[model samples]
Target: MLPDFRVRQRDYLLEIARLLTEELDLEKLLARILKIAIEMLAGQAGLIALKETEGWRVATAHNIPPAFLSYLTPLLAEEKVADLDVTELNRMLKELTYTASMGLLNGTGIALAAHGQVIGVIFIFRNYADLFSANDKALLGSFAGQAAVAVHNARLYGQVNIEKQRLDALLDSAADGILILNADLTIERVNDAFERIFGRTHDQLAGTPHAEVIRWARDPIGVPLEEAITDGWPLTPNATLY
Candidate 1:
């Protein structure tokens, strides 16, 4: 049989893998990861604080008292995990509670990075005297590794949605009929004007070959832009549609 710690690590990693496969929502994914962290470590309370250009914001919170939220936010802001001291932490807690509320004061922080740069940190905390073992840190780091990629992909997905909306608006407001083609010379988008002019539904033309759509026109030109250019006329794929 495997060691107890190894078994626990396997369980945690399995959960982390499950998190990676879920729907692409950055906030929800962060919350789920923090929840798993607390469950794996028996943490009483924890929160995920993400770094924004404006400042730090709480992405998710679990079992963390509102009072503690204000205190914990600034503590992790200017400092990394290495800089935190348990004795000093409890000393600060002394003012808030009658006695030492924190027993062990453990935190595992993982730096989330994208494109070779530091983006944010994932922090898990517990209020017990027992220190986190090497195994615990390793598992937490692995969790962060996968979490970073998911978060990055979610961000890109959001950016794509925004760009799509802008492109749609531009196409809708344009004076002339406009159509865009994919690199493979297939119709990607056709505006309202294009549909009206062509007397066909835009949805019908999507994914259809640009050449085929133009072939249906009155003049019946096979290729509108068929010039194997001589000089630097901005190289494009053999012009299937003008």
Candidate 2:
């Protein structure tokens, strides 16, 4: 039978795995991951620092003093996770942790990596004298692996959302009528110009087939617009009455 702590660790890891797929907001995801990591390791405080173009910045922290966090941020910002000197870094971190709170005596850090790239680092601080055990490190490693993937996914999701917003803004601002279609050529979206020109709202025309909406003039191209588009028609722009 598994030890109670091992069982709890398993449960925590499973919960993190679920969050990986379901949680896409990077801030919220990092907060949850940091909280879970601290709880799992029984640490007094913990933080996840994300690498940015400028430098490493604290993405989230649990039970950490604001003063300590302010100091820690610039300290980490001096170097990338890969370029960090572990021994020297740990020494400095321990010193700072001690200064932040005399009770915090032990600290450990692990790099969070995904797809062979180091994205961030996780640091957990404890009040006890006993250093983190080898098993504890191993468990934290496994948890960090999943957490890294979640963080990477959330970043990608954020980028995609930003691009989507940009596209929506462009579509809405267009002077020419624009109709976005799905694989089946159903109306996914119609821009404001299209709605104004056709006297139909997107809400009324969405998911409607293009054939049903537009009355083409007696098969000008001798093929349906869907078939024409599918067959790579309009080699050059040609005016067609509709």
Candidate 3:
């Protein structure tokens, strides 16, 4: 039978996996990751630092003093957490905490990576000197794998949202009427000008067949709107059919 703590660990890992898949908001996801890591390790504090083009920066932290974060920033540049000298790190932490009037701290961290690319690092600190167990490292390694993927996904989602907003703004500001269509010629998006010219709102026209919404009168050449669109009929950018 599995030990009680082992069962709890399994459950937490499963829960974190669910969060990783469902949560797209970066801040909330990082907060939860740090919270779970600290709880699992019984740490006094923790932080997750992400590697950026400029360098490493703290993405989120729990119970860690803001002033001390800058001191930790340079430490994240190390390729792996295992490269850190624990005794020397602890000594430095002790001196820093003493000067800041905080508790003596010791910590363990793991590099967060996905697809063999290191993205970030997570560090959990305790007030005691007891070294982290092999089990602790193993659990953290498993958890960090999922966390790295989640963080990367959340960042990509954010970038996509930003680009979508920019596109929406550009579309709404256009002088000409615009209709975005699906492969089946259903209206997917209608710009503000299109809505105004047609006397219909986007909500009303969206998902409706363009043929049903816009009754296109044939030009002098008796060309239909569908054919004109398919054949690039206008012949010039500013040319109007009627």
Candidate 4:
């Protein structure tokens, strides 16, 4: 029975890890994580507090009261993983005049870190009588690490896409012709201007050797080597561009 339980538990943990690492959208991933924590770990309430300039903000939450989250901000200033006992929970909630709904305040939290830098924290509050077990604490610890890495990767991918779009737009609007060559002398890129000036499509010029794509013959009027090359240049043998 223990072996079977272990196998099933490992499978579920892998699924959660996959979701945390594979989902590239930050908000969507956070929503999924909170939902999974509530369901899988039997958490009645959950929230992910991401560290920001002003302070920790509730980036995402499920069944978590705004007031309760506001109260946790100061404690979250110190990053660490901890399984909250009733003693500590009561101490933190002493001023709130705890309500019946707040009975499920026993749970665990972990600091979200990426590449050794703390980025955020995640919490899943469970029933006071049924506090988080050792297994639950370990699982949530693994989740925190995976979620942080996903956030970092998603941010990087978004920035790269934005920069690529910006560069493409700039190149398309440029007046001067531009051709970028690879280290092997093959054409890496040709801007819209280059395509128009050479009277060739981008697809036709790309990946072609510079020597084969450009006519390197002597000038008919004895113009200098560099001056001899002009806009109406014809392509060499085996060249697709005219």
**Best candidate, TM-score-wise?**
2
Cα RMSD for candidates in order: 5.5, 3.6, 5.8, 8.9
- Please rank every candidate by TM-score, starting with the best: 2, 3, 1, 4
lDDT of 2 by residue, 1-242 (tens): 99876897799899999998899999999999988888888898888877777766788898887877777777677755425544455566677777767654678888788999878888898888888988888889889999999999999999999999999999999999998888788999999999999999999999999879888666555566666666665563672332
The TM-score measured for candidate 3 stands at: 0.78
Candidate 4 CA-lDDT value: 0.67
- Comparing 1 and 4 on TM-score, the stronger one: 1
Report the alpha-carbon TM-score of model 4 versus the true structure: 0.61
Model 1 C-alpha lDDT per residue in residues 154-177, reported as the tens digit of each score: 777778989999999999888788
Off by over 4 Å in 4: 1-9, 16-21, 63-107, 127-129, 182-185, 201-204, 217-242
Query: Which window of 10 residues has the lowest lDDT sum in candidate 4?
Result: 225-234
lDDT, residue 66, candidate 2 = 85
Angstrom error at residue 214, model 1: 2.5
Clashing pairs in model 4?
none
| Model 3 residue 4 distance off true place after TM-score fit, in angstroms | 4.5
Can you give the lDDT of residue 117 in candidate 1?
A: 54
Candidate 1 — which pairs collide? Answer: 104-128, 104-129
The number of clashing residue pairs in each candidate reads 2, 0, 0, 0
